[model samples]
Target: MTVLVAISLTTGILSGIWGWVAVSLGLLSWAGFLGCTTYFASPKDGIRGLGLSIVTNMSGVFWAMVIIHLSSLFSVEILGYVVTALVSFFMCVQAKKTWLNYIPGTFIGSCATFAANGDWQLVIPSLIVGALFGYTMKASGLWLHQKLNQPNSKLAAAEAE
Candidate 1:
């Protein structure tokens, strides 16, 4: 099968398994999926992509926390919006750092954190595990593709027969 097909199948199977495991462990499955999406969306592949996804996602979480705390200080309500806007600007600007260059990953992380209601404890682990899942899926997919395409593999042998 094609590499794309292999990757798709691997991702689909692992995602279902991740959902089950996350729920069983009392973790946030959605956040894990977001982390997985971040991994695939990363500009780089392999370990570099993994690192970039994690760092950017964490940075997003940090910014979201800052927005949550700083906005809480004011009762103006509108100030919350203002603080969010300001913090969002900072989030975009922070992309100057190479590790945080993945803007979408950061946004995804921030959204996940917000959804978790600032519970970084749950969000952080879930994201990390999800990113790991993404990496594993890709690696497994490539391995499967290689095995299928090998010249002397069972498929090839059967075809020759």
Candidate 2:
């Protein structure tokens, strides 16, 4: 809970000068999405479901925007697509059995944007981007999980602190 609060404050501060509204909505949606997904996806109110879901957003949205906009002098759209793919992939990696669980966040945002702009051309592109980023997120998350679970790594040390 404390960590979540800290993340919220951090996100709030960072979003304040940028797309505050988008970030705020993204945060709330992410939380609700996390909770609902966990609730429905898990057989019991287990820690894995809840924890994984929370971690997905703890840094997910921020990174999505960060990678998309901060990576290079390339177009913002390229970054957006790359970020989306990477994040999505990482999500799959973290919760190996629940690959589909990670798609809602990406799909929702993509569909909404396409709908608003009535951009049929964007629909396919958005889906591809979402899948790529989603996979990256899953892979990275699972890697983090593995490294953290190691007996005597920095991740274990940090956990003991």
Candidate 3:
């Protein structure tokens, strides 16, 4: 089979498994899926992508927590918006660092945290797991493609003849 086909099958199967595991563990599968997407979308690939995904995503969670805490300290509701604005500025500025350069990952991570009602305990692990899924999917897909195209394989036999 073609590499694209192999990757597609691998992604579909793993995504199903991921969804099942997330639901079974009482974790948000969607959050994990976001993390996986973040990993794939990262500028880097392999281990670097995984690290960047986790770091940027967790940074988002941290900033969201700050927004929540600081917002609660004020009596005025508008102050929450102000805090968000300020925190957002810092989030962008943080891109100057190499590890935290994935701006979209941070945004996605923060969005997931907020969606989970700031449940970092659950969200953090889910995101990490999702990033792992992304890595596994890519690795497995390439492996499958290589195996199918190997010299002794049927496809290779046909091509050789």
Error of 1 at 27 (Å): 0.7
> After TM-score superposition, what is the CA distance of residue 89 in candidate 2 from its true location, in Å?
3.3
Query: On TM-score, who's better, 1 or 2?
Result: 1
What TM-score should be assigned to candidate 1? Answer: 0.93
- Per-candidate TM vs. native? 0.93, 0.31, 0.91
TM-score of 2: 0.31
Per-residue lDDT for 64-87 in model 2, tens only? 444434445466567767766776
Q: Candidate 1, after superposition: displacement of residue 14 in Å?
A: 0.8
lDDT-wise, the better of 1 and 3 is 1
Give lDDT tens digits, candidate 1, residues 1-161. 99999999999999999999899988899999999999998999999999999999999899999999999999999999999999999999999988888999999989999999999999999999999999989989999999888787766789988
Q: Candidate 1 lDDT (Cα, whole model)?
A: 0.94
**56, model 3: CA deviation in Å?**
0.7
Best by lDDT: 1
Once model 2 is optimally superposed onto the true structure by TM-score, how far is the C-alpha of residue 117 displaced, in angstroms? 15
lDDT of 3 by residue, 57-91 (tens): 99999998999899999999999999999999999
Reference-based lDDT, residue 158, model 2: 100
Model 1 pairs whose backbones collide: none
